[model samples]
Target: MAQEPLLRCSGMDKSFAGVPALRDVHMSVAAGEVRALIGQNGAGKSTLIKVLTGVYRRDAGQVEFAGNPVDFTSTQDAQRNGLATIYQEVNLVPYRSVAENICIGRARRRFGLIDWKAVNAEARERLAALDVHVDVTRPLVEYPIATQQMTAIARALSFDAKLVIMDEPTSSLAEREVATLLDVIRRLRDEGVAIVFVSHRLDELYAVCDTITVLRDGRTVADSPISELSRYDLVSTMLGRELTESERRGQHVGATATAAAPTVLEARDLRRAPVLNGSSVTLRRGEVVGLAGLLGSGRSETARALFGADPVTDGEIHRDGEPVRFASPQEAIRARIGFNSEDRKGEGIIPDLSVRENITLALLPRLLRRGIVDRGRQQEIVDRFIRRLDIKLAGPDQKISELSGGNQQKVLLARWLCTDPEVLILDEPTRGIDVGAKQEIQNLVRELADDGLSVLLISSELEELITDCDRVVVLRDGATVAELEGEDISEKSMLHAMAEGTAATGSRQPSGSREEDEVHD
Candidate 1:
């Protein structure tokens, strides 16, 4: 007979403020199974995970764990009952020692005293099982991100957890680190631990998961063995439509730049310590230039340096043929340069503020009169951008936090557009949003560029860069090694440039003008 599933949730329903997050969702993971839970942002993946881990109570459902009906009151309660979660960000105290973080709740005690030696030994044993060797006595912050992630995994297993849920565990990890984490997960599955892995990376799902469950809107849409699902079908199921080839490849707004185009912004030999070595980029008027690189290749660092959010150790920035230095973001804004950061939640929005406030944030200085905000002018600007961007919000007075991820991103974009920037730098502008929203943002970006606004685009997704950018610059080891423009830009050429710098024969050499090179498609 088949073994009973390790975890089973049937007819699970959850809502917040009368808005249903999950509707009759069902998921099951058998012992020794590796299951993938995937969906776009605001798709109830988080809600279901919260309910399972006791972060929230389900409005209606039947949940059984280990052949027993369970409703955990808290994460601690769930951990004690053999369920553990490792969030995308490592949650342990940074200043705490690795050993202490691992054996935090269940520290070894002897004679009413904490047993330090036993604690360290146990932590080492747990880490060694995952092939991670580290100085357990050292603070967690001293270690790399991969080590810290392993520490989180060790802490989860230290509770003798039967079911482990990893939420975007590899989002912050490099390629090799991802492989190592996947190996550790496989080892855990072999040891009969059921795993529920949550990630947006489709490659990771195919790599580690045996079964898959797809959630769309607020309901479970697909549940099947991972091997049985094609990548195209899986994406179609999650998106509720068979994406056209044009949509999948990204549809460009037919606009191209010529050699006669004026140079708007130029960064030469930018250096900012360890992350950025010697990066250089040139943006032309009415052109979208893509910055492509692997993780840790200094894509975001370059953006920060350009925006004056971070100072560069060396380099010069020329705006419209005039050399300029911005001491801070305010100065950059004054220079008519707008930056949309990749970290949307942390750096983009003030969650407590209203949509109108967020949309007009960067323009507040211009709207100030007698040291007071000009509410009339603010509303005018906010209303105009809201209508232009088509941001879906109940009202301008609604809290920015209440909006979905896509709408919130649109608000951020609006914040920059209101400034009437000469050049806009977008770092992963469409990340973490739904497919439709992503397409909307991409189209908006193209429209903005076509309007003669110079744009510097940075994205990890190559297809996005290919379709949206007029030219692509490949960054490796903190330097721009190759440039692909016009018809030369392709997945193969970009990948070659990224892997082996300057290997792509289509790579364009530095020149005073691109007159000879005209965009074909």
Candidate 2:
């Protein structure tokens, strides 16, 4: 009596090398369903998506699509069979025109020649459907990241796919762009397109997804209609524990006491041409200061400038009230400053290296004597931080790529901690990790600040800034607009400043807490 689902996977099992990435996983999506696939990093969400999309072969599983069992050998084969995927990273060629990137494989042909006019027109129309307008002839690298993301979405939908799998689609999108994408998703579902939406943004999941499937440690832990699951329960299920009242509020433990702490690093009037206009931030010893902003508001740019990864065109950086210029990351490191980048897969981890090597990467210079690494000292530091961070890996000798996303992140953290830096800059440190890993990183940051390490934290999550920051600096259009501390730092205040580019200096009580009002009155 019930309609058969459009896409279904049962008893799916996959392994890499000797480690199992998925086990006994089951999922189903109706013809017009928007299903959410969520889990902590390395919980097998990516693995299952890869298995379904033909990126990786499943050892054991039955994948049924449109009333037939299918095993695709490659992504192209899967795409041709009416299943399309937009990966977490945009897979389009950056150097090619936007039209070429969108219509590369399936370009319209006429008289044995590719139809350039038809291809460009189709790409333009597809992007326009998503409310994105751009020159299709221009190279994709010429567009902003948000535009590129929309282009990817347009390409996936252009396939007339029965089931479209989107992984972290809004990770680089601005709030307005995210709303547009969600609307497009709703339209797709209404038109009978099944969508498997993968994102860490809970609000987006609730907004667009019809069903929810949760994975944990390579197993299907929970599956239900989206309405039947509450946010708390969703997180609890993914984390494998019920969150406490404090944890629910994202309150990090060991809030630093740094009222009298001296400033360790300061950037004044930092200017970088395209992305960063003018931004500034100050980090004090024993303090965790958050740089809050929307995408493209210069949050990462500011962090990178401070780390000397991207040299600022005009700015002054100071250490201990003395002016300093770091032309490179090596110079910054030598000055006891460490940086963890947001692009974990691309910039943060060296996948080919072993966990031990990646962990000791930054500190290797100090561990070397006469151009030879002091293996004993390197191992001592690596072992200490691995245990301290609770990194989950087979052994230190294992390739870093073999570890889960969270463990890889911990190794990156260990890499910087081993440097014994006085100041650390973390950009979106918990971006794609699960709630449990997020909390652990937050706790570690708080503890580090408590132990007198100054941290400049950049995160798009307002709750993260409110929970862990001693001071919150809001950026708008690549410039600092507000700074809140003490009882003034709240979600409402930060959102106000981030949107309006004005200081939210406690004009009114934050809706997040009545305790502040009670205490104030």
Identify the leading candidate in terms of lDDT. Answer: 1
The runs of at least 3 residues in candidate 2 whose Cα sits more than 4 Å from the true structure, single-residue gaps closed, are 133-135, 244-335, 339-421, 424-521
lDDT of 2 by residue, 393-509 (tens): 888999999998878888999999988899999988998888899889998988898888989998876678888898888776566767777766776666556434565556332
Candidate 1 structure quality by residue, lDDT tens digits, 109-197: 99999999999999999999999988899999999999999999999999999999999898777668988999999999999999999
lDDT for 166 (candidate 1): 96
Give candidate 1's total backbone clashes.
Answer: 0
Model 1 pairs whose backbones collide: none
The lDDT of model 2 is 0.82
Can you give the lDDT of residue 107 in candidate 2? 97
